[model samples]
Target: MTYSRSQDSPDRRAEFPQTDLRGSIDGLLNAFYQGTSKEAARYDLTTHEFNLLSACLKRKEECTATELARVLPVDASRISRIVTILVDRGLLKRRRLPSDRRVVMLSLSEEGVELTTRILRRINRNSARLMEGIDEDEIHIFTSVVSRIVTNHDAIQNSE
Candidate 1:
């Protein structure tokens, strides 16, 4: 009288893979995204602001607005606006390059460094929690699939 979930209705697998890999990945991302912005809000930063800072932190040396824009893969104007706001907030510092005054360089402000460090730590903790139940092998496979999908998307974008 009682049927297991899979035994009840498993025929969809014939048409759609049981894993529904892309959908599964998208669902996981959507679910995680719901809570992630809330986490950034705790520090008064929108998720996008946090991401912009995170990109700046990737380089050891001061990076130009153009550089951040390229790595962020956003329009130069967008990065310029974001950088200007962060600078006014004292979360970032911008200066003219000593050797080339026309070129501007940017680095995290002392406070920016502190804030980004805390934000990255929190994100890493969340990431670890998400992976908690999965074994190492499962994680490797999951990462591989995600990587391949990302590469494919990038290739498709480049083609356009």
Candidate 2:
């Protein structure tokens, strides 16, 4: 689960749907995520692990476990488990943050970076294929609709 910073934008949030937005959204995601997972398998990476590694690569330094949990939309305990696996696989290094000893920081290993880069490239190519025949305007409209839902969901979460 890569953390999308765009999720914080009011224009990109979403509310609970009175219609079947959930189904539509899930279907869209499942198709893409499933394909991405198959591509990741060649590198022995789980879908979630690949996503987390990619997110870590976007940063200049290690991220604390709490940050991963919050940003990835996973519960803290689950994030902890995932981090442990990543570390055991030599894909990540876990250490105490210099500023806060209580926080565990995560950073990728050299091999981890290479592996993730490959996976990202493959996934990007696969996604491009899916959008190949679609017009740019259509893609823009689709993305815009999804952005609105994200904004509504953010509003719902904030109110709660």
Q: Compared with the true structure, what per-residue lDDT tens digits does model 1 show for residues 1-160?
A: 4323355346765566645554566678776775567677898887767777888787867989888877775789878888888898899899997799999989998899889888788777887888788999998987898798789988998999
Overall lDDT per candidate, in order of appearance? 0.79, 0.80
Off by over 4 Å in 2: 1-23
TM-score of each: 0.79, 0.80
Model 1 residue 104 lDDT? Answer: 94
Q: Flag regions of model 1 displaced more than 4 Å.
A: 1-19
Which digits, one per residue and each the tens of the lDDT, describe model 2 over residues 62-160? Answer: 888777767786788877788888899998998886888887778999988988888888888888887888999999999999899789989999999
Q: Kindly give the number of clashing pairs for every candidate.
A: 0, 13
RMSD over all Cα atoms, model 2: 8.7
